[model samples]
Target: MSDKDSESISDAELDRQAEVWEKIAHRPEFEKLLTAKARFIVPACVFFLVYYFALVVLVGWFPELSKKRIGPANLAYWFAFSQFFMAWIVAWIYVRAAGRFDRLSDELLGEHAQPSETPEK
Candidate 1:
């Protein structure tokens, strides 16, 4: 095939892909997937921010309380350190949630995927 033929083929493929994506975007399943991701992400973000800021606020506003030693380190230090673990825990939760998201995406694509004509060797 010539370069022009190849270019036209690629352009046609892109156009078809766009059309398919447009259809998928309008699908209820796609909306549900978006909603589910938002539902988890929005609250997770809120919780993380609140927890992170609460530590800062406590340290700033109530230095005496924050200075109270737990083991060798103070409450502020412990809280700051715990943010790392909190981040890891949130990431773990998101990974678990993302499995469901992947499943939903797979199901959506499975429905939408065009059957290839003559399997490539």
Candidate 2:
């Protein structure tokens, strides 16, 4: 084919791809998944930020938490220990929320399916 013909073919292909993408983007299932992801992401991020800031503020405003103690340890060290517990709690909360969100999302997006029937052993 001539250069002009090849260029026209390429342009047509690009337009076709764009149309296909537009259709996919407008599909209900795609929108639902996007919404679900946003729901999970936004809350998780908020929780993480709030949790971190709370710890920082607590340590900054509470002098007892920063005081030194025996055994080369300080109040900050003990407060940091408590922060580890907070980390565990946050992690657990995130896992539970993400799992529940995933299950609901699968239902909403019509991605989950039951297993096939099987005979007893």
Candidate 3:
């Protein structure tokens, strides 16, 4: 595309858009969205990290307990394998939670969006 065509919005239009977004950013709905996301994300992250590291700690500190076999694999192996399932479960939960977050975001943006004035080519 030529530069003229590529440059869609004028600087003034861009400035107006920035101001609209600035206003949106200060709204209570924006704060609610951020807080909701952080609430879910922080706990999920901490839980996963603790679960992941517990295996290492168990193997190092209680080798006998971790080495006790159940079929062909030991406790450590089972624990490690379970982490895969844990990760998948976490991902599933996050996906469900993210749908709610996205809806809230969409509503927030819809409420704040200004009518576009398309610059003619």
Best-to-worst ranking by lDDT: 3, 1, 2
Off by over 4 Å in 3: 1-22, 115-121
- Name the better of 1 and 2 by TM-score: 1
In candidate 2, which residue pairs clash?
Answer: none
Give the number of the best model, judged by lDDT.
Answer: 3
Clashing pairs in 1: none
Which parts of model 2 have CA positions greater than 4 angstroms off?
Answer: 1-12, 64-79, 89-121
Question: What is the per-residue lDDT of model 2 for residues 1-121, given as tens digits with 9 covering 90 to 100?
Answer: 2244435556677676567657656667667767766887788778767867776776789777568684678867765676678778878876877786677666644642223211111
- Provide the RMSD of all predictions against the true structure, rounded to 1 decimal: 5.6, 10.6, 4.7
lDDT, candidates in the order shown: 0.85, 0.65, 0.86
CA error at residue 48 for candidate 2, angstroms: 1.0
Better candidate number, 1 or 2, judged by lDDT: 1
Total colliding residue pairs, candidate 2 = 0
Index of the highest-TM-score prediction: 3
User: Which scores better on TM-score, 1 or 3?
Assistant: 3
